[model samples]
Target: GKTQNIYALNYNDKDNDIKISLGLLDTKHNWSGWISPVNGKGTKSDTPNKRWNFNIQKSVDLTNKDEMVFGLQYTKDSMHKTEHNLVNGELNKQSKGNTRSYGLYIQNDHKFDNKWSILSGIRYDNWKVYDSWMQLDKDKSKTIYYPARSDSSFSPKIALQYKIDDESNLFTSWGKAFAAPTLQKMFSGSASSASYTEANPNLNPQTVKTVEIGYKKKFGESTILGVTYYHNDINDLLYTRKTGLGKITYTVNGSTYTKDKQRVENAGTATTNGIELDLNHKINDQWSMFANYMYQQSKIDKCSTNGAAEGKIMTYVPKHVFNLGVDYSAGKWNSELVGSYQSKMYAQDNNSDTAKGVYTAYDPYFVVDFNLTYSMDKNSSISFAVNNLFDKEYYSYNLCEGRNYMLTVDYNF
Candidate 1:
């Protein structure tokens, strides 16, 4: 269960070409679940988070064909979490992790003529962990601490667009992306089957280079179509490695040691090639439809530990996925139906589809949802939705949601 509060305010002065915004967010979550089916015992956890940020943006016209954009932002965030397990009818601390980050960015957009334009941008980030410690009831003397540390990253992107004509356009883009390891990934432990994972604060950010080409066409006011092809080269991809004991190194008491534990690491290099197609059409004011499909192939090129692992498909990358939806609106009623489909996907690295439970390949499935809405007036409406209309049984690493129903009443001011 969760509760959240978010509020923001924006001020704009068109005469000065300036805008300022302020926002705050607070959230709380509580979770309780059985640790195992054998026992009637359970575990519970509570987490609270808060954040505040301010941003200022300015737009300057360098000339008729060029413009510059400036942005400054600052944010503060904090969170604390506690976990407890039923032990003789008492509760005890389990573990906790904390994080903070700051960011700044700027962009430039230049128009060469009516036919071509270019946009470029850069961003900087500083993220750090302030506190992370843990002590389990089973191992009281094994208290662990991840020293406070900060990392900085800089990313840049550029894109270009060309107008083929009034009804069609073409575009290509390239970007460098960065992602720091999350707090939980940096300091957490879990288990599955015969393997277990321990945190590694020495993990580096996952980096990737992406290139894309796309085209879109508008046919009158009734239809729109688009197609895109993309490729991504990923380096230092943060991933888990399941190897023999003593394959990983750790530090303790000012001494270096090796252990046989599953850990997160910059495992290897990967590449992804994909194509996407989408279409939107209006049959009339009362009828509309949209469809999209994607074909993706992702593969690990080389493994840091075993070169034999190369050329294997990346886990969870479905080779095919598609969605189709139709909408109808007439009189005081509106209805929509959407169908989605995905091909089979493996759940583990090294293409080990023989593993049991979640470690095996997940079978393909198709799901459908329908929504109906009735308007009581211009100010209020009622809606009914049926998810998984066919009650398809499926799994994406685990059992997926079954058929469900929902009713909602919405009022507008």
Candidate 2:
């Protein structure tokens, strides 16, 4: 079943990116997202998820062989969802929230003679959730207002490299990473209409400490191979409880009310040990092949729920992933083919979806894609692509898309 509007043309917004590098200064600005038109009557959309980022970097000389880099960055992210009643043309506001982030970082690269080199960097980030509001309506009516919230963190990384002969090299590094809740999670208020779900504003960020070692080698100018083994220790990992309960308060029409709200919490700790391999080879002047594979094992080191989830594997994280691809080029024609595979995956923490005789899991699946392009000149090209070329049946929770084809024409000014 389908419908069509033959007389109208749909216009979609595009991303805006600008970058500059001059002398010792470098800067980048990017803005993109979908915003529901507040006044466009015929268009429909999900919650608007608008984002903006601006960063600037400067290079300074600490010695001639040693260099230091300084950077400053700012970011803004917001989500606003609204819907209009079809019959009466009345507008209703569902959710509104925004967040801002400021960051500063410094790094130094030092070359100690011809055989040894090192890079070290430290970053500080501050995030704030502000100017957020939520209401089913707008007349001093049913609404919940979230309080302003903030979080800050410091992360540091260091790496060293050594020259082995002239064709191969070895490297090792240690780094700290952190993830904080998004504006949607930190500022969403409880919906009075829902009986048992509410939002929390005081959740802690997840953090990981990583250590890695690796070796890489180049065989001539057309071939390269690299491999790495790494481990991560993650704490205060964030997972949604879904049925989490907390108290909420709001006022309407000279009356105040309070109720329990359900949301997510900081609930677990985990560790991952993994190995990755990458290889690329150019068979000749017109043909090349590339492949990569990852073997990862992650376990729940601790669970706050203290039940079936205590020792289970993390959800949706596969133990194996492999990708293989090749490319070809002729006078005016270019072609590529790629194949990818994933091992089995579980969809939930409980791992209990197996109400049947067997535990239901997402089956391992493989997919392949092909593309061909013809160049008309230096400024234009036409491409035809076959995605999911075999139309494999699979599921990552829900059924995946089937085989499809596309043709595109691109031009540059």
Candidate 3:
């Protein structure tokens, strides 16, 4: 079971073009299930998480062709989890942590002329983690405390656009960004008789540099087409590495156990290049259609821990993807039909799992979906939807969901 609550407040000054916002979120989850299929051991767990957010921004018109905007943002997060064994009714594990982040950014939009425009922005962010610890077992009286860590980064982005005409444009952009490791990736751990994971508090942030170019144009009055190409270079990619196998002693039972230890590390560098194409057409006043396709190649250039993964395709990235959809509307009724396809993908970094249509494997799949809605009046509507209309069987680490149906009614005041 899960419960979530959210609260938000906003203030807008229309005369000055300024906005201020504050938000809070609280969430809780509780569940009990079997932990081991062979032994039929059961366990219960509880997790509670909370977040606080604030933002303030102002927009200023510097000239007839220029605009400037600046903003400041802050966020605080806390998470905790506890698990107990059902058989013995004893504490199995517990983990808790808090994180805080601050951000400042400024952006400008400038038009050199009617045909040329540029947009540029810079952002600075700082992140810190504190008050983090983990307990393995209550009866064993063992605990681990993680040291506090902090890091800061700066990101810059710029884009230039040229309008070929009123109906088409060409644009190019470059940017640099970073992503900090989450609390679960830095502090969470689990252990079994065969394997165990260790938490690492010294992990660094992952960074990427990106470049993109695109063009869009309209054909006649009802058809539009867009195409884009992009490349990315990533550093400090994180991955799990099997450190070694060692003997560990359990104090509660006074027994020794052999287990393989795994830890997360900044393991490799990767690159990705992709191209995307999109098309849209409107047929008369009652029908419209859209289609899109993407081709991508992602590869690990170097890996520090696992040499076998070098030059291999990255995990969970499909080489080709496609989507097509059609929508219709008449009087008080509306309908939509969509279909999507994905090519084969690898599930492991080493790309060793070759058997498809099996557990822990990735397989190519195509699925279709449909939806219909009827407006009862100006204030009410009813909808029916079907997901996975063909009931295709595939694996994405696990088996994907089969065909399903949903009916919903909505009303507005």
Candidate 4:
């Protein structure tokens, strides 16, 4: 179960072309479940999170063909978590952490001529993590505190567009970005009867560089086509790996049990290349259709810890994906039908997990869905939807949901 609250304020000055915004969020999530059905053991967890942000931006019109903008942003976030064992009435695990960030950015948009235009931006950000700790109780009680860490990065991006005609254009973009590790990945740990994980405090941030090129065109005022190719180079990717095996002692009884232990780490470097194609067409006033396809190849270039993972395809990334949909509308009725398909994907970094029709297996699947809505009046409507129309059976770590139905009603005053 979860609950959340959000509040926001915005101020706009038309004459100065300035905008200012502030936002706050509070959230609470709790979970309780039986750990073992045979032993009647249970566990409960609680997590609370809070965040606030402020942003200000200003735009300047230098000339009819050129414009510039500048912006500043700041954010603060905090999280706390606690887990307890019901049978023993004792704390099993606990974690708390906070993060802060500051950012500044500048952008310029310019048009050299009627057929050429360019957009460029640069941003600098500083991120800080502090006051992070984790505690775990298994065979014994232990507590670990993470050292404070801070880092700064600069990202830059540029895009150029060439107009072939009024109905078509070509565009290309390149950018570099950075992402810091989440609080859960760096300061959270959990223990159970069969498995456990340890927090990693020395992990580094990940970085990626991307380049993309695309073309879009309109045909006969009823159809549109788009194609794009993109490449990404990533460094310091994070993944969880089995570290070793350890013994866990049950507090209710002094019995000890062996379990697998895992930890998160900066695993390796990776690269991805992909191409996408999409088309949209309008057959008549009451019918429209859309289709899209993507082909991607993602591979791990190097692995510092496991040699088998190098040169293998990344886990959970399918090589091919496709989607098609048709929509119809006539007077007070509207309906849509969509189909999706994906190739098989691996479940392990080494590409060694091959059993199908079982738990923790990845399998190829294709499914179709449909929805229809009838407008009863100007302010009221009802909708019916059917998902997984064919009841396809597949596994994505666990068993996928089969065919399902939903009915929705909407009314407005």
How many residue pairs clash per model? Answer: 3, 2, 0, 0
What ranking emerges by TM-score with the best candidate at the front?
3, 4, 1, 2
Cand. 4 Cα-lDDT: 0.84
Cα lDDT over the full model 2? 0.72
TM-score of 2: 0.75
Return the lDDT, model 2, position 383.
100
* Model with the higher lDDT, candidate 1 or 4: 4
lDDT of each: 0.78, 0.72, 0.84, 0.84
lDDT of 3: 0.84
lDDT per residue for candidate 1 within 318-377, as digits (tens), equals 999999999999999999999999988865566676443343238788999999999999
Compared with the true structure, what per-residue lDDT tens digits does model 4 show for residues 214-290?
Answer: 99999988999999999999888876655333544443223345565677778888999999999999999999999
Candidate 2: stretches off by over 4 Å? 1-45, 58-64, 83-93, 136-142, 186-201, 220-222, 242-263, 305-307, 354-363, 374-382, 408-413
- The C-alpha stretches of model 4 lying farther than 4 A from their native spots are 1-25, 35-39, 51-60, 73-75, 138-141, 190-197, 242-260, 329-335, 369-391, 402-413
How far off is residue 338 in model 3, in Å? 1.7
Residue 100 alpha-carbon offset, candidate 2, angstroms = 1.4
Off by over 4 Å in 1: 1-27, 35-63, 72-85, 89-93, 137-141, 192-196, 245-261, 305-308, 330-334, 354-361, 373-383, 408-413
lDDT tens readout by residue for model 2, 1-413: 11212221222222322232222111121212222245323312135466666666667778977888887877777766654443344565466777888888989999997889999999898888877776656453777777787888899999999988677999999999877777557544433222334455567778889999999999998899999999999888776553234566743222345754545667778888999999999999999999999999988778785456667777668899999999999999999999999988765566544332232347788999999999999989999999999998776545677899999998765
Query: Using Cα atoms with residue i matched to residue i, what is each candidate's TM-score against the true structure?
Result: 0.80, 0.75, 0.85, 0.82
